[model samples]
Target chain A: MAEDCILETSGLVKEFRGFVAVNDVNLKVRRGHIHALIGPNGAGKTTCFNLLTKFLEPTRGQIRFNGIDITREAPQKIARRGIVRSFQISAVFPHLTVLENVRIALQRKLGTSFHFWKSDRGLNQLNDRAMELLTAVDLAGYADMVTVEMPYGRKRALEIATTLALDPELMLLDEPTQGMGHEDVHRVMELIKQVSANRTILMVEHNMKVVAGISDTLTVLARGSVLAEGPYAEVAANPLVIEAYMGTEASGLASIPANDDRPPGPLPGEGDDHGSLRSNSGGAG
Target chain B: MSRRVTIAYLLGLALLLAAPMFIYPILVMKVLCFALFACAFNLLLGYTGLLSFGHAVFLGGAAYVTGHALKVWELPTLVGLLAGTVAAAALGWVIGSLAIRRQGIYFAMVTLALAQMVYFLFLQAPFTGGEDGLQGVPRGTLFGLDLSVDINLYYLVLAIFAGSFWLIQRTIHSPFGQILKAIRENEPRAISLGYDVAKYKLLAFVLSAGLAGLAGATKTVVFKFATLTDAHWHTSGEVVLMTLLGGMGTVFGPVVGATVIVTLQNELADKVGSLVTVIMGAIFVICVLAFRRGIVGESLALYRRMIGQKAG
Candidate 1:
């Protein structure tokens, strides 16, 4: 491990049954840096994130965060260690006010145990802190509005603010700009930069422009293995990267072609459709 | 919850507390007990979005414990209440841990199956007094103050009901409750945002179970009897009916539902007796299909609409 490395994984392997989802992944994320993982579909970017976050255990290999092994820690335990994740789909609490959503996350980080008699100390401080995060994301004005009522771009911003509540040392972002309009993508990219100023970040992104715009180093994966690893410019020009990006749909479909062309399929009463639909949707790739 | 909603709730609670003067104290006691039970159940179903059809296990389990403590052990009333609550809390942890592995419909069925197991256990267990139940248990006193008089018992029941109601309102207002709501709305998103959803679900379940136990414990002492019907699946359906009719997520919704349903049962007890189950099932369907948000929820919405109109 290098002196500046904040998160590192060595020989990471994750398998389902006999099939490999993430095969022998080795990577390192430097402190106070924006590192992006860009790979084609079925490249196992999400599986790697899941394994590292302890949502799923690896078949083999170890992950170290801030020089401590976190390969086997529980998901919440890993979160308590100051690592947090952001999803492509917004993770903000929709029914709660935007401020309340972030404040709840902040309260959780402050160990807000379930109690019927406690005072509102953590709650007040958390509310203030959530406002600060929302301020950073330019969402402060919408603080009291229900998150679901907010525009989509603002909702995405709320997710980032909530993730920031964990006080993360290493932030794992899974497709931060998915399904965004150009303005939202640009805003999210700007927010990501502001967030990374105090943390180390590892992201799996499909949008090349966003990756190139902010990433200090970029790691590319193809078919569950590292294809290239370097700065965005180097990784962008790599022949292997281009091949993998273009080759993705062919190999991805071969493994589960039935799902790609199959109709919405029969209802549950049809029997065989249930088993097939379950298998198809149950994570083959 | 909105500010106007809170104001409306306080108004409703005031009316409910005053209702015993008009209605029979026994009727008020029954409603309060059932209301507490439903409110506790709502902590899980409403906030965490996990439905437990086996809550009778907690309700009935506490009834048995409190009944046994009062009858066999001759314990103080408060001691019986605490014993019942602790027993139910422990049971909730065990059942919740296993049931939480599955989600949605599976979770419901798992709870239902587990409740049936508890039902049979009560049916066979000696301490539960089998079919006859533990009869003639004493309400005794609040620290030996002789709560035997109906008026005294009414106040005691009122205090317990109010305390439970306040505790639930406070719990939902807490940050932990906010997190539970988040998990209910979007569990995978909550997990990605670093919450251990299973832990949240279990915590909500345990809290709901404990309060429900409190309700059951008080009920046993109130009526001075614990019967097989207390632990029956009908009771489980009864609580669900109350929650649905009251408002699944709103604080006062379950209380209102409980009061109305209990009153309906009291009215029908002499007329159609055995048909209570059929009527409750029908209400459940009607509530789910036609009036999902419930009476209090609907009332709150109307309040909001009025407020909006005033602001405009």
Candidate 2:
């Protein structure tokens, strides 16, 4: 109920049949802070994000955004309320030009979302702004190119650019740097930091360095419940947080010591450790 | 790019102006009516990615309405056409709301089932004259100009066809059309961007249905009768064939497809009547196997390739 909290969830619960995917939990994200949600595999991180975005209905609990109840709002309705989200998979309109992908998002703010009678040529006015967002993400030169032709990492950047076009007050990023190269991870991490200025971001990330490097607040969920919540350093040193992650694969966790700068290598399905690293399924926690 | 489209438009206009002097006006009018029908159907199928297998309900249902208005109610030609168009639009809104609940093939099947219901309704409806249909529909004067003559009727049909076709082209290039394409390509992404996808789909359905109704109403005036054949399920399949054969996404594709299919039907009616469906089936197969993009799509790709080669 704090005035500074932009997004607050109380007793959020989601159950799939009989199994509870996201158990009762409360989360509050302060305005203008980079908050990261991290947990091991099957930790109900995605389910929680889906519940917040209204993509999946919660079995119980309420979510308040900007002091308004948004728990019953439609996904698009919540998006209109300035809480926009990006998918874990690069979610770009593959057939549309990169410029068009961004322009469609911008069109919503201009009140032209349902203007079927007007020529799309009138939308040329938004091109300059779309280009600016694309340029910020280093995609200016590829504006006219179809999104499918863009490289993997660049597609993720395009997704960020499209999300940024919404000018969201509370951006929910689902694994911003999920599948990327080392250089791409660094570039996207920097891009996220640049965009995070003057905006509140709640991201579900697995990359330790990206989270530790940028996140002002961290919330770790294990087995459908919050295990630790605090500043990155405090949560990173939390004994329970370390055990929850280490109990999974340990390879990605073992590399990150108590006070080390070198973050763990790419998580599952990223690069070299793709097939070798499996998402830990059976979590008793 | 606009210049090229304008040139094509002007060329098409010139060809149409010269057509009635040589070919039969009635046949050409038939082609134009079917062409518009196919184009309207493409708006939903190609642009919105929602296929309605029962689209003939709009076309045939409008024909019956217009025919009844002209023969029974004795309304003016324009007024009857307007009534038919409104009726079809209302039907589209209702059917689209129900059909949009399901997706892909399920949507198509729901539409098909709805069309069958409409078909039986018309089959027994008193105003539609049952199997005999509404016969001897009067083609009244248009703004003081008489349309009883074949040449006069031809020009009026031509005007309506061109005007409706232009409206459809404008709709496709509109901001609303862009949203339809966005939803077609990636629906969840469109939703994430705060679009009410259901509303857009329903609007498109209504627009397409209104235009298809316009085509049907005009066809009644041209033919002087509204028959069971117009509302038959076979008519739905034929429009799909025309749109697919000419290219679903291209603007001129439906016209080309309708012309080809209608011409084939006319030519084969007397010589090889029974084989017409078989030959049409063969063409469909060939188009699907070899030119899946349809005629216009293939040509456009070739043109783009040639331009790319020259630039490279």
Interface RMSD, every prediction, one decimal place:
2.5, 1.1
Residue pairs clashing, model 1:
none
lDDT of 2 by residue, B65-169 (tens): 998898889999999999899999999998889998899999999999998999999999898899998899999988888888888888888889888888887
Q: Can you tell me which runs of candidate 1 are displaced by over 4 Å?
A: A1-3, A119-122, A247-285, B1-17, B143-145, B188-199, B309-312
The TM-score values for the models, in the order shown, are 0.88, 0.93
RMSD of each: 8.3, 3.1
lDDT string, candidate 2, A1-285, tens digits: 345999999999999999999998799899999999888788888899899999999999999998899999999998888888999888899989999999999987777767767778988999999999999999999999989999999999999999999889989999888778877988898898889898999999877767766788989888899998988667766788767756535445444433424443444454554222134664221
TM-score of 2: 0.93
Task: Please state what fraction of the native interface contacts candidate 2 reproduces.
Answer: 0.79
* Candidate 2 backbone clash number: 0
**Candidate 2 Cα misplacement greater than 4 A, ranges:** A1-3, A247-251, A254-278, A281-285
Q: In lDDT terms, which candidate is top?
A: 2
